[model samples]
Target: MLTNKSSSSSARLTFWLGLVGLPIGIVAGFLAGASPLLLCLALIVGAALLWFFTSFEQAVIGLLILRSSLDLFSGLQLPSAFAIGINALTILYVVVALLTGKAVHTDKFWWFFVGWVMMQSLWVILLPLGGLGMGAAFLPSAIKVWMRYFSWLMIYLLVMQLKDRVPPEKLVSLLLLSLVAPISVALMQIFLPASILPSLLTAQAKAGSNVSGTLGFPNGLGIFLTMFIALIWWKLSTSQKRLPWMILLGLVSFVFVRTGYFTGIGAVFLLILFINSTKITPIRVIGVVLFCSAFVYMFGSTEFGQQRLTEIYQTPLLNPNIDISRAIILSYGDGNSFNWRLAHWNYLIEAWKQFPILGYGLDSSPVLGIKDFRTGSGFAPHNDYLRFLVEQGIVGLLGFVLFLTVQGVHLVNLLRSSPPKSDRRNLCLLLLALFVANLASMLSSNIVDATTFFLYWWTLVAIAGWGNEYWQTHRLTQSA
Candidate 1:
């Protein structure tokens, strides 16, 4: 009855929202003096509302639209506007929840809380040291990084508090919805003329090509796609529903090649096959074979596709020239690039021989010319772990490793105690996928993209604790 009441209330809310939205949209169209396209969009919204009778987070969408408009006026970019809108909505949601006394912290809050406290405390400690200017050069970039971290941290608190507010089905739905926008952008890129394709691609290179989709980072885009692919595969293999998800999966895979990160495709196939084989039937086996065949046909045909596979195959085996081979591999077999990462690692190890204790203060490496060793570019090591070793010395790296070790150990214990059939399994799978992706990313990128890194990291921390929360909830319900 309560469920129905909520549904009915939600339906009524949608009706009123649409009823109000139509005229307000018209007023907006006239007052703002937007283009005909904007006018048509407003009309389309009204039509969609009338036809579908659907309820959406109208307030949030309106906020995003307003932000985009503001950005257009200010000559700021679209992605920046989108990011601002997300941050604004996320913070507003958390604040409102807290004010309404609905928010609660998770058991894992201590991990995130401590991590935040440490970062803040370290910043205070490093302020007088003046070493932070080295690697973290620009004031805007540095502040933006911290702001991203803090925004995601707050988002973590919201998720931890509202775990019950989102059901498994809802979670699945949200994940699917998130894919729609990106998938659309990716498809547009795929279908666009060769002349226009370059303009569409974001700055980040997925397969050493400028084909980044909606996400700024190519690897980030791939990682996000892999997450959805995992979810779809899970649902297709486990749930009775298959056709809808299977079609969606196919569509996603096709657009996936737009980035040309074949590794992501390979990872998806391997993980899906591994999970599906646990209960593999004749039909399932045939499905896997068909998917793999399609993947190969589509991906292997492209120049970027052929190059990635070639690189993987040509990745030099260990020999007396292993360092030389590695340098070639990192630079995509280019001998002229100088590949400073190796030299960066060598410099850090050599420096550790001196002040291994506290070493240089945070962000102090560039000041000492750590980056000037090989490339003359004065860049940090591409590898996050190596960067940690360089900047923090042996002690700081160990501290970071210890932090990760604790998280890993805790996850293992939680998974071991969790029943196989429980929803906690999803949490475990998601975390495991994220962990693997982070690990893979760090081998080549920086810690800024890794396990302990961004908003997603904090969100995962809260998610890791959800298993125990759900278990407790289940036990109480059973008792009742």
Candidate 2:
């Protein structure tokens, strides 16, 4: 009876919306002399927005899927004012929930990050008043950069809140289901000749120059894949329908091999060794590791991988090398290479010393530019550690440290409380492994604000976080 009533209401609402919207749209289109395509797109977007606002559950699920997939039009050159994304939508959702008095929850890591962003904002806001030469013009860009992390906190909290409303398995299932689009694109990249496809959609030479799917670059795509695979690892542990997951697992693994990101391999290696304690034995671990290593060696060692390995293994002789610090001064030309990054990092450290405690204000590191060997150009810091110290100073670094510290607590809590081979315990292990891989990757990659990667990563974090509390309370009380 309720279902029928809901259906009847939805039907009437849609009918009214179409009736009202169609005439307004036609009039606007006619007045503006708009094309059919433009009008149609507007209508579709309008309908989607209406649906998104009207239905909370479906809206959140759709947002997850869309975030995992593409803003297929993202690469297009558009005005900043026209931009809309998961980050923007998150703020809107939270605001509406608050205004409507809808209940929400936050987790352990939320306030620390929010507090940090607030502090960072202070640095940005104060720099102008402090006569730092940088104007308030930078505040907008700083907020934009800040939004990525802010959304990350919201996503983690939102998922933790959703635990009671949605089943844990279903949440994991949503993540698994999110894999289809990227996987299909990856498979397409493998079979199709690269000459025909858009370069923007593919990986670089180091990553086989074929597959990145919807993700714009190799490392970002690799990170997302590693995170999602870790989520699947949690689900696979206790699934009765093992064959389907195993099949999906095989495909993701095959694609991971094709990704050719060194980190992905290392991440999988970690998972194989320590996914769950009860399921782990020295002999079994050794066997599986060897098998995977052997298979990867046989299948994953493409021409690019071999050549890349040779390059990395060969030592540089600065005496006769192009990469040698020939000039005492570094220029923008000395960019993107490993030596370039080192030179740039040294420069940032020196510049950071000028404003050591508060640093050169927020977002001030890169714009310091290639002032001899004193700073990098308008490029990412490439090392998040340096980015924190140089940009947000000690406060930023401490906030980041505090955020990671909470993860460590959760890791210890889950590992000790939940038994080996159990769902919650395995999930705990996967989150820690993924977090380690991400941190290690951060040593060389400016992945702190990698949007697509975090969309998947925080989902895993949220799941593990919610489980941490639920299992601890239940098990401890029951056992006592």
Query: Which candidate achieves the best TM-score against the true structure?
Result: 2
lDDT of each: 0.54, 0.63
Badly placed stretches (over 4 Å) of model 2 are 1-50, 77-102, 130-137, 199-210, 241-243, 276-279, 295-300, 315-340, 363-378, 414-421, 467-480
Question: Which RMSD values do the candidates have, in order?
Answer: 9.1, 6.9
lDDT of 2 by residue, 1-480 (tens): 977866765676566667777888677677457577766777776677668677766677666776656633455622122223544656666665564445567655566657665655666667667734356777766666665556666677656556666666566677666777778777778888777767655534354553676665555666777777667655555665657766676677777766656645666676555554345557656757664776478334665455545434322323244443532233245332555566677778877777767666666667764544454337778788888888777766777777677767766675676654456666777777777776777776777756777766777667666654454222211100
Give lDDT tens digits, candidate 1, residues 1-480: 977866765676666667867989678769458577777776776575443222224433333223212211223455444455456655655554444343345565456555753663453355355643233344444454445555555556545654665453444445355565566666655566545555435334433343545665555566556666766765554445668878988887776665665546756666666555445577777878998899888788877777666555433333334465466456533522234445455666676566565555454454443444366655545566765565566666777677666766666666666666455554555556556555565655554542112434454456556665454223111100
How many pairs of residues collide in each model? 0, 0
Model 1 alpha-carbon miss at residue 313, Å = 4.5
Candidate 1 has its poorest 10 consecutive residues by lDDT at 471-480
Candidate of highest lDDT: 2
Candidate 1 error regions (>4 Å): 1-103, 109-113, 120-124, 131-141, 197-210, 262-270, 273-297, 318-380, 413-418, 450-464, 467-480
